[model samples]
Target: MPPPALTRLSVDELVGMAGVNPWELHDRLMVGRPEQIDELANSFHRAASRVAEGDGVFGEARSCFQGAYSAQSGGDTINASPEVTKTANDFQLGASQLDTISRSLDEVAHALTTAQKTTGEYVGSLNAALSQLDAMAEAIGPGSGANEQQYNQIRAEGAGVVGSAGDLVTGVVTSYQSTLQDHMALAQANRWHSGSARRGGDPAATIPGNGTDPATVKQWWEGLSATDKQRLIDEHPDRIGNLNGVPIADRSAANELSVDRDIHRVDDVAAAHHVPSDEVLAHPELYGLDASAVTRYRNANHVLDARKTDANGGRNRTYVMAYDPLAFGGKGRAAVTIGDPDQADNIAVVVPGTGNHVNKGWSGAKDSISLYEQANKADPDHKTAVVSWMGYDAPDSPTDPRMLTPATARASGAALADDVNSLWATHDGSPQHVTVIGHSYGSTTVADAAAANQMHATDVALIGCPGTDLAHNAGDFHLDGGHVYVGDASTDPVGMLSSSPLGMPGISVAGVDGPGLGDADPAGVNYGAQRFKAEASDASPGSFVTFADHSQYYKPGSESLYNLSTIAAGHGDSLGDQGMLAVHRPSVAPVSVPNPLGGILGPDRINLPNPLDTGIGKLADPELLRGGVTDNHNH
Candidate 1:
């Protein structure tokens, strides 16, 4: 028996079927007559297949019909024959099963159609959401995050501005203080001398000469009573030298007293006496000296020697060949000279590194001259001079420790320092500031010298320094007001690792605080201080002592070189920034974004009429719709 047609039959429809009880149909069709129900399902499926193989909407409908037919195969209509009442009941069961399956198929078809519609709507929503996001992104521009490049750039610029401002302020204050101090010192000196002179009984007595013409004043002074003259001499010990030739105080005072009245101008007197204006104004005792005393003093303080010994045992030259009588017959003779020998300025000395000798290979003489030339070039305007002291016998290479020990090197440096000081004293000059430029082992020598107070250079600059165990802190090295500058190019490997265990272990020639000199920190180090960077182009090639090292003490155009020159010339404390920002500023304004999501959403998503195109929820609109469709239709 064929099963009953079940298409269009809902659960209620099945219950309303002719001569059918809902409970009985469920029990009989679902549980019995399976064969009869299968036959009816097969026939229905064949019909549906023919329809499904067609096109368009009809094909979809056919697929739905096929599902209905398959359901009917499980209906209870198999044994509908008069021979058995049980078979008849089974046939009824098959018909009931077919109806139930048909209804299920119809429901499924409806769901699929609905899902397809939903998917189309979802696609539209997704497109709208993407459009909204794009608009927002456009409005925001880009730098909303804290890590954005624009934000970082702005911060850096701000910091630079602040730092520059601070530096300017500091410079101004320092200059003001320096000027005030100079004025005070000058006032004090004048007051002390003027008061003493005024207190003396006779103005002429205080003046050290009569009011007569030059010749008469000399005769009157010569004719003074021995007791009166002796009393005057006792009062001014420096004035006693006037009876002979030596103006006891200094050349400036002596020159002033001799020619000032005759020339009627202090400047002329200064010029004639070869004395500085300050010296003349500060001290009056050295004015007017007799020839004999002057000659005696000149001989006693004369620096240059008339005779000299050749290094190779030959005739000696005037300026170059004078032998050091103090170190007679020694292995070497050290000659020291000061440039711009003036008391009001600063000083510097450039020490060459390895391969420094007197012989043809690496002569200390030649290296010293080269360094002097470089220093002059570094700062032509500064009143600074370079002292080229080749005290130690620098090695061709790092061969032996005995050849270079701090103690031994220090002894030689002390002698050299003594000579420098003596020269300064003899010339009536003193260095207000001093800097030492030491390259490689020369740095070692400088450190030792400084430790022993030999070279009282204001700042110590160590280039390609192997090691100096000086105290880490400025106080430790007794240079509280002084600075230590270390310059090591990033490419210089030796500077990166060299150290001394005996002295300041954590200090390096560079400015860092470590086992070696510490890392390069520019804030604390300036002027003759270590500058950690590449070698300046203007630096002399020999400034770098090591063969593989090209570290120069003061390159012509290098920062280190300029700093040394400025400090040595007494301008180190007052140099302002040289429009460095103009030189370093970028050529173009950088493209930047301030906010990431400010533009597109009108700053408020829910308020927009088209929420899908302008809201936070719009972010997932596309994916959300697609998901809804899949959930509705996949089953």
Candidate 2:
């Protein structure tokens, strides 16, 4: 009775415990293999035996037996038989064994439950580790070309195992935090150490007064040569202050081409007044123009300059003239007059040739102007206006043609023609007849202008022409309806040269016809009807027949110049000299017709034919052969 020991508990007491299960739990515990079952049964039996020994109830029962024995028989005699005693003892032992089995089963079940939970937690942690590894691997995988399929498989498996518990979440967070810290450390090291080293030395670290701004220091450091900076940093790391904060000099701006300033100065007053700087510089006559003309031109220049100086300066009108050498200017500005602006009259444009310029004296402008002035003077009854157009960039010499080709000459001529037409339009004037008198290379310039449709001159007179493209007839150049007069002197050396191979080859003259320089009279020695003689009076009487050079065509009093003026003034009938009569005839009159020479005559057998027998017919006829066709003739 000192304390009821646990061993004093009866079987009923043991069975009454809340956690104990007698059958199902005990069965599980005893259901193992015989060895394990036996060991468990033995342990249970031992525990029961101890309990029975200490139990107050069982001891009391034993004491009762002892007392009964003493009461019923004096110390030696037993109340019951041995068999019954053995049976009761056996039953008690069996009950004790069963209780032990039941207790063991309960303990086993609890242990299994705890172990399963612990294992699940451990598995979950392992899975989370794998999952974090997979996530980190994916984030740090190859950037451009990665094996996506393998990554996805790893992610899916890891996610499945990690989803089971919270411990895995903690592990993943810890791993990510460690990885982030490591990456940040690496990045900082790269930026601070590696980048600073690349700059040769850290100015902030070495120099006392160096600014803390890394960018500023870096820019200065970069300005140094790699080898030099490295040498300084390595040789004197402590003395780096000597090189710190060096400033760079700014570069100066370079000179550039500008269009806003004038490029030339004019010394001659006459040139400054009358001629543009470009022309004056190009020619020699600008220095020597007449004082009177220069005065008039200066007045005009002042008016122009004043107008241009005004607010509405751009509205001022001006004219640009470009003349070539053969464009007969003998002294200065050519005196050209246009009369009766309202009347429809004859208009003549005189085109000179090579070696023309402004500063060469008045001869450059005067000669061409005189031709026109003379034409107008010769025909006072008729309204006539003459234009001494120096509308070409003429060659400076015979060899200058090599520089001034037909194509270049044409552009200048076309521009001049356009200006001329504009002037005519502005003045309310229409030339009833227009004639172009082209001399020397000016003939070629005129042909090009006409070909480009830049000139509407009714007649084209080519004097001292080297030759045009022989392949082209007068019609091909748009001068078919108009008179195309070719004047060349027998004395002219250019007249002797072959004028075939006409079109511009890359550099050479090709397909030019020989000189058909005589008068365009089939009755005459030169049977080419379009070729006309350079008049003897206008030229030197013996010059055309003797020298055969090009200059005689423009001699004063020469019939060639006379015929040119006469035709230019719309008076073709006035040209009655031998050369003129050879070409002149009424358009309506019938002339002798010649049949084609049928035989293939040898060069020696070919004889001179009559002018009427040749291809001479009325100018009205569209189909008449004025000259040889371009394929067989020189242009």
Candidate 3:
């Protein structure tokens, strides 16, 4: 038989699209499109390096110019060379702009590399989960009968894995959209340099709600054009969001943009380090941070990034009402909401005690999320939200002398009051219940906030408090006695520290002359505030989990957590006397003359014992707060 004759293409077929050269097309198809992307990234990388080098050159020249000018010893004109100085200043500004562009390009390139790797990992996980599902199906033997219960259980678990993979994809899309929005905001800010954004005067002019009503700020904001509003966000997000009169929705939105912008800003400021290929081409999650880059990166942006995710991989919406990472010389202040408060039926704003701020924002979020989730469970039909308000520069460590006094609380209380009111300002129609919950020194903050202005809160809860500064009883808080709740663990120490006369300088000095801890212990039956039972099941890091220690307040499944959530959810049961606590009241200090040691060794130093373990000073906490009589020893 003759070799199979090859079918010859007709001239008409050859003229058609199929007649294109197969070999050349295959080569181009395989490599062309992807190469375009790679080339763009590589080119950007090269440009960034060259621009960075140019900045260093300009910086050196500026330094030399400064030195040469300084060395000249003559009159004004000779000593300061205006022409030279201007040239150097111009160079510095040019270098800065170049550096910014270079950094932005690097970020774009890293994002591309990271996306590719993530896709690969996700595809692998999807395949694995699918394989497990198949295995479980096969295990049932199809036609043969098996233990129905066991088969269902296996199938359920497999299905969960598949669902989780789907959730992962959804999360990726959400994160990308969020990141894109952040980048857009930053871009707008980069282009905005006009001085017109401050038409409302300085944000600090009236201190949000101190003297001016938030409604006024809202009115002023509403009158402005959309362009002006955008200008404010681009130029003064920190001011606009933290301002009391601003609408809640606008503030939350502005602050959200600011949070992401701050994170990227941190990256720009700390971009001096070289992100070598090892990290540049690594995980997008790392954002091209090397070992050294990682440290700088975290130091600069961890506080902002930490708020993005929850304990689980799931994303929870956190509103950044106010955030200043470098406030008070880098001590930091931030207020993060667990869910939307304006929309929630019940809202609780939690003030963390001393030794906590932006750095511990995530840990604070974990606690607030617990309260948030629990509140949801308690009131399944209504929305309940929590805000981890570390908006104050809390007294640093317990060892610091400042923590013992309410100086920080006194300084920060008015802001807290304004913030609480701001929540209501943004709410339309009638009103929603507002609860201000303070933990440890934070209780003092809450009390001070209320006493300074009308807090508008329906309830005030103090957990593990030292003392309320001045209000002798719950009646002094302006809120009804039944609405004030105090939760003091049986083992908590500083809990009662503020309740004693010694906790306050006025009390310890001359029969309550200075800021003493407890004007009157709210936990005492005489104080007339609801005292909920608090038993330690999970103490702090260094202490044992005995009923005699601290730190079980927000522990999962703990009784205190249950009661706290109950009140936060506006639960009727929380008001019932289920955990009504009764404890021995500590004796008041005898009025005495002032002494130096009295300042350091509070009344408790004189052997107050368990009796001093009073719950948070609920009503007069602000009075005690004004006294700066706070003991966040275990907060």
Candidate 4:
């Protein structure tokens, strides 16, 4: 049904309406207690945030309780996981409804305040016009001459003025009514008691499962109505925040909510344990929090802080591309981008190596920012984004047994492939020039993703790599441009793992993939990858060069960093002119030396010299080791 229009007021009626004190009404609406509505709205938002945090706490408690239950019971015999998950979902829905109410209140208050101010102005104008008309009528009283005609014309114009004022008043009234109706409907739709009904039961059931294909998930998400999408974001951010195929901006908004909830959860847990929130990190066990909870707190705060203040003196837009505080057995997973990846013409995903977790993830932020700056410098006309993707569970220590096999890397590779492909699925416009860079063990993971999982990328760079696992040659990656770049420094111990006879044994043991053992190096002469010069220090080893050189590929003002920047910015053709290519060494096969008594030696011993050795015996200046650039591991 059509809505009724506002009544048109006559001149005399407008005069009556304008009798109220315009100044008083203006003061009341603009500067008085009505202004406090903003504060009230803020309070409701804060409460909603607190409720969301409580949901996170419930999730953590569920995890802890499930662990205890599993230890006591033979298995998950009680189905505690589902029950806890549902409870958490319910709490999240409540929080969403609270946020909805807050927004509605804010909208109504703003609209009414604006209308009251406009109405006051209209009333003042109308009263002045009517008063002037009265004065002119009195000035030409009881005359039938030119003065009488002028008075009549003035009265007619005055009526027109009154009619215009009536129209203006009508607009304000109509706007006020519309605002009230819209907000009232929203409030009713998100009522506390009937949230489930308003939301149509579980929102999770309406969306694609987390394990769905990235392209399929993207299609499903795009197919949703705008209203449905926003409802999910408000009510079930946990589901879409880290979902593979969602758009970057929407994921960022959802993850930001997730971060806030995590911070709130930490505080609540601290309060429950009678400890200060700051002390939660010092003694997480006191709150029944896993070690990962501390890291989660740190990671969440890191993202929040980045939003408030610029880091490394750069004002690049920051976004939480992915966040999962309880993922990967509580080690956690997260990805922070220096610029919006979806908007950038060039994008680089920097995957770190061992000992990186959510707690120490901020270290990679510095590298990401630096790489972003350099990549921009390389191609000023095109926009670039760098992502520090700590999205996989890495070995906590170099000697950890998980490094002995390709299982972790393979699994992580699949995840990485999905993440990269998700970016391709959700990016804006034409195909982006995407580069995936990995260091040390992360290189192995990247290789697995590209070779076995069909990761979508234009270029791939591996630095300080121990091995490539199933990816033996550049062709194995199947990159868009067939460009597989390698940045292996001669003094890097880890990078030389495949070439060094001492380090090759362990890699060979861990190189098993299907029925065949994979080669241990992508930078070897026979590997067919395009090598770039990455010797940040002297080619010979020093006190710090052994392990420290492994981390220098991304260092500022270095040749390797420059070459990487060029590749990331899709300007790789200039690398040759810039003298960034490493010297090519011919592949050397192991030669057999026949012994005079061949039976005594079992067979002829085989040996070959590796051109990419770390030259452990040849030490560089100690001063260089002491005062030179330190690795990120130290930082």
> For all the candidates, what are their Cα RMSDs to the real structure?
50.7, 55.0, 25.6, 31.7
Q: Pick the candidate with the highest lDDT.
A: 4
lDDT of 1 by residue, 1-635 (tens): 11223222122332243223322322222233334434554654454344334323543554565567658885433222222322222232223223323322332233233222322222223223334433433444555574354434433433332232222223222322332333333223222123334335443332321111123223334444566555554554333322211111222233223222322344445678899744544553575543333322222222222112222232312122112211211223333333433332545665666555432222334333334444445456544444545444454455332222233343334444433443343323333566666776677666656665444456766766555544333343344366665655423434433321112212232222322222222212212343433343433433322334345434434544445454455444443343111011011111222323222211111111122221111121121121111111100
Lowest lDDT 10-mer window, candidate 2?
250-259
- Residues 236-343, candidate 4, lDDT per residue (tens digit)? 887788877788889888898889887887899887877788888787786777766676777788666545444445466788888887765566778888888888
lDDT minimum window of 10 residues, candidate 4: 1-10
A best-first ranking of the candidates according to their TM-score comes to: 4, 3, 2, 1
TM-score of each: 0.34, 0.36, 0.55, 0.59
Model 4: residues >4 Å from true position, as ranges?
A: 1-202, 268-275, 280-295, 302-314, 500-506, 509-520, 538-545, 591-635
CA lDDT scores, all candidates in order: 0.36, 0.40, 0.55, 0.66
Per-residue C-alpha lDDT of model 2 across residues 1-635, encoded as one tens digit per residue: 01112221232332243222222232332333434534664665576566456454554765687788888776733325443343333334334333434444343333333223333333333433453544554565554445565554544443433332222222222222332333333223222222233334443332212111222233344445666565554544323411212211100000000000112223344246775654544443546533433333332333223223321233322121221111222222221223322243776666676665333322223444435555665676666655555434455665442232243344345444443443344333343777777676666667656755456566777776654432144653455256667665544544322221122111222122111211122112332225443433323333223444466555555656666667777765445443353332221212222213111101112222223332222221121223321211100
In the range 310-344, model 3's lDDT, one tens digit per residue, is 54454766677676666443556667777778788
Of the pair 1 and 2, which is ahead by lDDT?
A: 2
Better of 2 and 3 by TM-score: 3
